[model samples]
Target: MDQRAAIPVTLPRDNPTQSYWQLEPDEIADLRSTSSLPDKADTVIIGSGITGAAVAFNLLSNGARDVVMLEARQACSGATGRNGGHTKAASYRSFLGHQKDHGTAMAAKIARMELANIRAVHAFARDHGIKCDSTPCDTVDVVYEAAQWELDQKAVKAMQDAMPDDDAAKYTLHSREDVWEKFFCGRGGDESVCGGVSYEAGSLSAYQFGVGVLKLCLAKGLNLHTNTPALNLEKLEGGGWKVETPRGVITAGKVVLATNGYTASVWKRFQGVIVPLRGHVTAQRPGLDMPKEGLPGTYSFIYEGGYDYMIPRPKGSKFEGDIVIGGALAKAPADGLEEYGTTDDTAFNEVIMKSLDECLRKYFGDNWGADNSEGRIRKSWTGIMGFSPDGFPFVGEMPGEKDLWVSTSFQGHGMVLCWMCARALVTMMGDGDEKELDAWFPEIFKINEQRLRLTFRGRLS
Candidate 1:
């Protein structure tokens, strides 16, 4: 059997491993607008994560009424809730590859879009007073390998040259000594520390942000149904689609699939194109010797094969000073190949868990000190992320499928991509001017016949 087809990318599983962000359930966590499923709607959105919330927000805010959203589990209980909450976009890491494939102008556009998306998210939160602890801070990418550090320097310089002068000014490079003294408290040596790059980034409670957005949409008369999985989709003869769910079927003029990792489950055409990859995360208490106020900002420890990203809980928050870290794919079996094409988030890999436990101790050295009363890790969990054959996400309408749209395959960078992607998608759905969207959104993200062919070929090969 083909390995990709053999792995099941089913619907979101029940009783998923608890994530640190979802500990305090929101009021709309299990919201069901009506006693039964609605028979019809102007628009139906599958998957109630950030993408779904953003799509509903855009639709309702633009005078589109009768929009319904469906969730397989509790609202915001997918990757958005389980991820390490950082709106940091490490675009430089892929700048060289993007430029080589698409060209300098497109690469620069991609980087700018990411930064703009981060700002939009923060601005939206502040404007709505959605108290999700959204904070803007400087995020650093600390290099641990000399060779990788050199490559990153070149990538950053190339990105800076391609981007606008104002955008380029946000990045700053540091020497190994500066990194050691500033970030590591003068701990790491030559072998462990190799310079760093700092840029404007942010950290927030994604679950809270998503739920808050949903609450606003609900106030505007958006219908939400939790624990309502979209089992399948069928095309209507005259127009629109019939979305089949366990409870009932909804005939909507438009159907929007915001399902990320489990998209293939309902849309079989994306089976191989959008592979599901399981990711792990942990919330750890700062050691006794660590600073009571926690580290200054968010961080990413970059090495040769993989990188680990982290964010500290806000000082006045309940889990103040606690570090939320994730990504140890290099240490996982087969360098994370074992995690691909899997949608199970109920359990985690022991090898990755062990590496996560040792991560802070290794980086902070003796200053990490002994564990607290509750030990190092307060909670650990897994989430499923959708990965496209190419790094870019698949947005806009599906070819040959009228009224059916999609905004998924975020490749675990949903924080920096979903909001804007959702906005652009809604614009296209409403027949808004494409040239206006073209000014900010990347054209490569649009779904076309050529992209679909290439994606299918790449998956099979």
Candidate 2:
């Protein structure tokens, strides 16, 4: 059987594993602006995750009120809440492959755009005083395998040569001699296993971030309806869309599909192009006596056949600052494509669970969990991510669909780029041209016919 075969896409799964971020449900989790759905709205945003809330906020900020945001479940309950909570951007890790895939100029633009979004998020969190556990820190891309490390070095050099002034390229690549200190800092382990590169990055609780933005939007007259699934969308006779939900039908001048992995449920054309891949995540608290200050910054461990990302929880908690970790798709069955088009986050694979169980011990050594009292698994869950064939998000007016814009298929990097993408998209939604919003978006992210014609082989790397 072809593992890459497409599956019937739908809304988010009913019962998903709860993430640590949702440990304390937000006031807006299941909020509805009104007891019943409104009949009309100037703009309707489907999917109240990070992307949708961003669009709604920006649109309202730009004086476009009467915005309605609809969600299938609780607000930000999908990938946004289920994510690892890391907000770091791609420094030079994917620059080489992206350069090869989309050309040097476009790749540089993508890298720069990602970094800019990181800054934008930090600024938003600071300016709004959003207590989303926003942590502005550096990220270390620790490479353990010899081959990948060498490739990373070459990629960084190439990126520097191409865009010398690129801030993303302004990272310190540590060698074996200093890699251990740079990575562990006398915490994870003392052994000099491999090397890594460190650069500016940030982390935060995405659920809180989204809720904060949604709260502001609601204050500005944004109507949000939770547990309201957008069952169908029909083009109105004159100039709008009639969105059908279980609650009621609502007409809107414009609709933005920020649905991400569940996009195909509302937009059928994204069937093969936007695949929903299920990923597993784990949150573990340190033992009663484990050192809390050891793991300071966010980390991405790149090994020979697998990779895992981890972000530490904030200090002073009953759980004693658990570590949220995910990724290692390489260890998944059938080259990981077996999960290519799955919209199911209700079940998690045992194989991936076992891999995640042993990741910290393998990378950080025995210090992570020497005994039962030291390392305790707290919560484990699964989330779905939208994967685009071209490995870039579709962030513009849906091709051939008037007034229907989409900001989906972020390929699991939504936290790092969705804010800026939404900001630029709202501008595009206005009378502004691509040139005016060029600084906030990459050219390849734009939805066009040529991209729509390409064969999608479930390539998410």
Candidate 3:
């Protein structure tokens, strides 16, 4: 059988590795269009992913009214909803990449911003009652050691070297023994996290978080529309966007394009800019050794490990069942199932399923729960994020369009980056300095001066 045919969704589940919040199919939109938009508004935002929500939330918080949020699908169905529920205050693995490409200053600033996001999420949760099942558990970037691990450390130090003096305070360095005590004490070496960096952030329920976010937006009186895909988009006379949807037209003064990966056509030139990419995951019976419902909070990452994340729900400690997971669909397919070297996970395959089972077995040891077998693989999803030919993602104007901003291409790391992206975009669009932030921190965004042809375009470079 072809390896491509062996796609992980054997039972044909939906985004198998997704957590509890996303297990259910996305909620449908009720479109309070109980009435229509007043033909005009100061600003209108499209695509309701976390980024769009964050932008809406930030703008609302900043006292901007007449702000409306529209969702082509239900809120969060895009990357904001379909993403790994994992949340972090710092760039998890990409900080290293940030250091290499941008330099120390940018990298450090990105790191600190992540931490702030965690604080912001919790604060939002408490104040606004956005019940995303937010948690305070800190996450660890663990490694098994070796030169690669050290190089990752050097990236961290370079970040420290670039951060302002005050921002650098409270940074910690854990020894091998300390790492073990804090994370893997009494654990087997094969599963041991030899060394790691602790950052003050963890995962959240994406679906729940999205609902909370959307609900908040609704409360603010943001008009919403669903099942209304923006098929045709153009700039309006009053210096805004005119998006033609299947059901109605969305004309607004300022358009915040938050389509992570969907069918929203902004500019004819940006058609190929946001090509759709798919990612997958698998779930299994909890291992016997897996900590009970509420185990002390710890989100650990293993170097070279297939995937780096496993979070138990709040009930695990309170005595509710725990959800353990590892692995996302590995190889991105080239073209179709027969092709390789790309990410096309249309259906389930055995290769990923077996690999994930092995990872679960290894992490939990001989303790996987009996009868629990494997959780039913529920849904399969594909998200479209714009990718920068350069390794990192893009956040800024819509290539050739005026007054249009695009944030897409998350690779596999959208959760943390999305928030950072939204905040940065808002700042750039408005008059703001890094006042709340340190001066040593460099902005994470860079304008792509040269417009390259898109990957999905009919013609190639």
Candidate 4:
């Protein structure tokens, strides 16, 4: 689809997350020595993370010219770069909802679309040569520790029955056998209940992915700036927009806001739709001795009381040594772990550590390797993600604004191609159908007049 002509917008800012992504020595050298600020453009993108990068990459490739990207900090400094790096086929939660609201077929379609997006992401990566160390594996969605096998069974059955025909051969329904046989476990499992759902997904060094996108855009003459934050936005006469910052002003016909968690306060209407929520994540330098069978499919980091996730990087490929176990401990009642995050690495102090520690005690009990094996806590930090009451992202134009659009708030799993989210938004902005795109996402984002009444009826915040 071709977009109408519009001036570009660019803001200059330095990259802020070179260390977090563990940039290769060479990439780091280039980034350190080659940073620049945003310049003038026809269209100004407000973020430099995954979604912004994707939109810019696609927009530029789609023939939009003179586009510039602006970031408050360095690229990938947001959730894009901070995620657990697992790209799976859609949301298990979304699938469950589909089965409930529309039935098995609709839920199947949702899963199929998600699975297809996984393949699309990989295919695009290959075609574009965007190397982010992406790894494809089947993930197992384990039930809550005390939950039953029936939970996993019932969940996977709905998924399997609703899955698209193209991916039918790519999955399997197994009892704990798949989890047990594929990845040996010393302890901490219940045999009688819900099993794991095995399906192929991908993982990558997330920061690298965003960095690569920025590099690609830079190569394409897309003027980008780091550190330059848009301080204000002025609606220009004749149907255009101009963004003001401490540095300068950028005039563009339209603005695309992809600021997920760190969404700016410059825009009044957007203030409500985008809610920034802080999430805590901890990564150890390198711990754990891998089993001979290799790492099990990485999936949702779930447990009894807290959520946890672990993945081995391609750097060692499980042959060398060192693994990182990361998950949510709890909010320090003192520090308010839920709203405001604990910057201290030891937030998992006694209180917060109980649940994960107990899970460890049950399975590895004094297990060496997981969390340093000697029960040592490594590094922990807070990253923010846009949150919503119902967990749906607002991916269309500002409800009543003209020529202004947004793609914000992904709660946790943005693995789904929220391309659908953006696609719907863009389509609606350009007078195209957004139903299919809207269907794949959470129900609350639909733009109809009664959408609110239907979605959150008595649940307004």
Candidate 5:
């Protein structure tokens, strides 16, 4: 496929590979608030993942009635349901690059916002008593290359130097010896392991959290329609929009596209800008000789061109001690370029599965003894993520598009950016205090003609 070409994205495929995190569907998974689609609504949100859930929750909590949400598949079954179950923000890894592209202040602002977003997600889950198995824990980025390890040290230092002491203290650099002793006790002095950095992070069932929020919104008079994809959008001359769907059409005063990877399918302007990339993940049972209590915390095995992230299922849960691992793009064909611009998730690449299987044995060595009776690998699946050329989400209203708003292109870091981005977009839609938003939200995330033009030029060049 010519990625630069303006090819319209396809809708979510039916019978997608079953995700480990979604093995047990939520009660609201196939929910339809009413028997029939409403003729009109005050607000219509496209997509029913975390972004849409956050937007609807904020709108309803603020007394906005007549809100309707549309989902293309089972509710919360998109990227939010198929991700590796992490709420981590490895901001230091991108500190220098962000500082060079944006200014020091803007870079610092983005880092802080990411941290704040993680805290907000946990707080909401806790405050609402959402039983998503949310857990606060430390995360380690284990570096494999010496050169990359050196760069990581400098980036961490730069990030710390730019932030306040309290926030800076959240990150700590660890030597190879330290990583082996503290986290990977079974590695047995692997010379290939360089070092690592640890920081505050978390893990939770994103599907559960999103469904909990949507349940709250439903109680607040919000309408939700699942298995109903928005096929096309028409703008009314008098104001509002006409959202065409397979079931029926719904006219709304305002429309919000939280579609992420599927955004280009409905909005032609985002065709090349918000490119779709397929990612694979798996749930594996620990070896018989491995630690029965599970690993210490969330981890990212960082290498030259790609990384694999893992999060342990909470202790005492049905799948306790099982590790949810994902990302082996480097081993895939063309370094995974074959995944770009694809929306199908019905199947996953066998190469990625083989790479993940080998990775476990390579990293764990002897500790990863023989597989148990149940087998080592439990399940594998694929999900699509939206990639922005500029590495920032497009928030706020689309340039020159009246009453139409967007909060997509999270670049696979939606867990750390979606909540706040959705909140900021809704605040702007409600004509809330602009000064307050300016003080907290990163200005770089807002949509503007300059960003649109730059991305278009890069794609067509």
Candidate 6:
């Protein structure tokens, strides 16, 4: 697809909008491990979001030193910091389409792979002692549309029939008749009447996750330079590459592009393949009238023409009584496509914000925001996500660019994809063993000339 005509993706804008998660900044938010850019390094990772931090951490864990990471803005200042704080994987909602596109074998592989990614996130948090509010929770996919609910029910049955032995296959599905009882437990009143499937999921502060792991990597001699963008890249006469920046040029043996939405800025060939998509998220705190228990678990309002996801902050945490919700782009001005294709995320769209507000009120009832006595909307912010044409992230080495690896374009599912892909990418780099990598990564995620030749088909929502 010739996305060149659409809004072009560019470097992270200076003074980009701040997010609720980044309200209390971390010490390493703008840390530079070294006084200046290193003259040379064995590996240089770009974009210090979760992906870059994972790459650097895995490299150090595997005994590889002399690594450096460059970020255009503050650490974890991009989508990772601006996300809605949910790490949900695909369930029956997208199972049928995936099954048809990649056959049952790859489809099943993808399903299990996502589950593993979610588990890996929890394990990482526990192992590293990262207090990122990482919480294990169940996600209720609530479909308000009758037709879509029926279709979801059928898909759930099909998945159970196909993957009978898989542990995750036994997702508890609630029919429309029992949605209130199963989901709200009759607490939120008659207004709470939407439910479809409830599955295992997790939530965490993505900003803290990125920065916490990055601190561990820095202790192991990882040179990180924030506020430094890789403006231009060129192949050195020898075998490595030279990356130019306002600070200075740095040479590295291998370069990894962890710049999720802004990937096309450094690699022009990815102009259309890895498209930038803007999304909005809002944070709200419960008022005095609401119960302290609040909503039971995370939620996804699956409407016929729109959807919104929400993850409530853990109790007693810094943002204790707050909830972070994002989506409803379908209510945006331009069919949500124009909003998705755009690169700007400096402000929130009022139309979508209004829709999200209405959704919360409808689900929670009239007492939700009754004179700020229940829960009031605090703030709304936006962030850019990379939407892959094929609905999969572009991982592994660039098609023809040797030693140039990429782990971007996650289709707005970066939380579940970044850590696992980074681990597998580090393994592949340490040893050129395809069989080993095949065990960790699915074939659909690899980048190659064949996949690049295929036409682009927009895959949003």
Pairs clashing in candidate 2? 287-374
Off by over 4 Å in 3: 1-28, 35-41, 89-92, 160-194, 263-265, 271-275, 283-285, 303-306, 316-321, 324-326, 329-346, 367-386, 431-448, 451-461
Point out where model 2 deviates above 4 Å: 1-5, 185-192, 287-292, 316-320, 372-375
The local distance difference test score of each candidate is: 0.87, 0.81, 0.55, 0.55, 0.86, 0.80
Sorting all predicted structures by lDDT, with the top scorer first, yields: 1, 5, 2, 6, 3, 4
TM-score of 1: 0.96
Q: Which stretches of candidate 1 lie over 4 Å from their true place?
A: 185-191, 455-461
User: In model 5, where do residues sit more than 4 Å from their true spots?
Assistant: 1-7, 185-190, 456-461
User: Higher-lDDT candidate among 2 and 4?
Assistant: 2
Tally clashing residue pairs in candidate 1: 0
lDDT by residue (tens digit), candidate 6, 1-461: 35432456789887767788888889998889878898888888999999999989988988988999999989989999899889898467778888888887777777777788888988999998999999988888877777887778888887888899796576887866566655542235434345568889989999998899999999998898999999988988788899999999999999999988899899888877777778889887654454567667788878767778988888767878687889987787655766655667776677887876656656655345453655477777889898777778888888777889988888788887888888878877777577877865789988887776655566644
Residue 238 of model 3 has an lDDT of 61
Model 3 C-alpha lDDT per residue in residues 1-461, reported as the tens digit of each score:
13421222111122323333455554443454436645666777777777787788777767778876666555566656655466654453566776677775676666766566666666777787766767777666556645646766775666565664634223455666666565543255255545667756666676667667777776776666654556666787768788676567767777776765442244444334444444444433455555454445545445442344666556523213454454334422322223222233344445544544455444433444343544423333333333434444566766566777766655555775667677777775676675653352234443454533424321010
Q: For candidate 5, write residues 1-461 as lDDT tens digits.
A: 35532556788889999988789898889999999999999999999999999999999988899999999999999999889879998998888888998888888888889889989999999999988889888999889988999999998888877776847336888888887777763374345888889999999988888989899899999899999999999999999899999998999999999999889898888888888878899889887887776777899988877899998888856688888899888888777767778888998788987898768777766667788788888988999888776888999998888989999988889999999999999999996999999998999999988887655322110
Tens-place lDDT per residue, model 4, 334-434, is: 33333421112212354444433334323332223454454443434445555444545666666566777777766555655544455445555454445
Per-residue lDDT over 1-461 for candidate 2, one digit per residue giving the tens place of the 0 to 100 score = 13453687878879787887798889889999899999999899999888998999888888887888999999889999889888887558788888888799877888788888888887898899887888888888877677888888898898889889868677878876565544543245535356888888878888888889889889999999999999999998898999999888999999999998899899788877788888889987654344557466788887767678988876653354677889878897765777778888888888898888777766665445564565468889889898777788888987777999998888788888798889888888997676767764787888898887666776545
Model 4 off-target regions past 4 Å? 1-20, 23-40, 102-106, 146-148, 164-171, 186-194, 285-289, 304-306, 315-321, 329-337, 340-378, 418-461
- Top lDDT: which candidate number? 1
The local lDDT score (0 to 100) that residue 116 gets in candidate 6 is 84
Considering summed lDDT, which 10 consecutive residues are worst modelled in model 1? 452-461
For model 1 the local lDDT of residue 19 reads 87
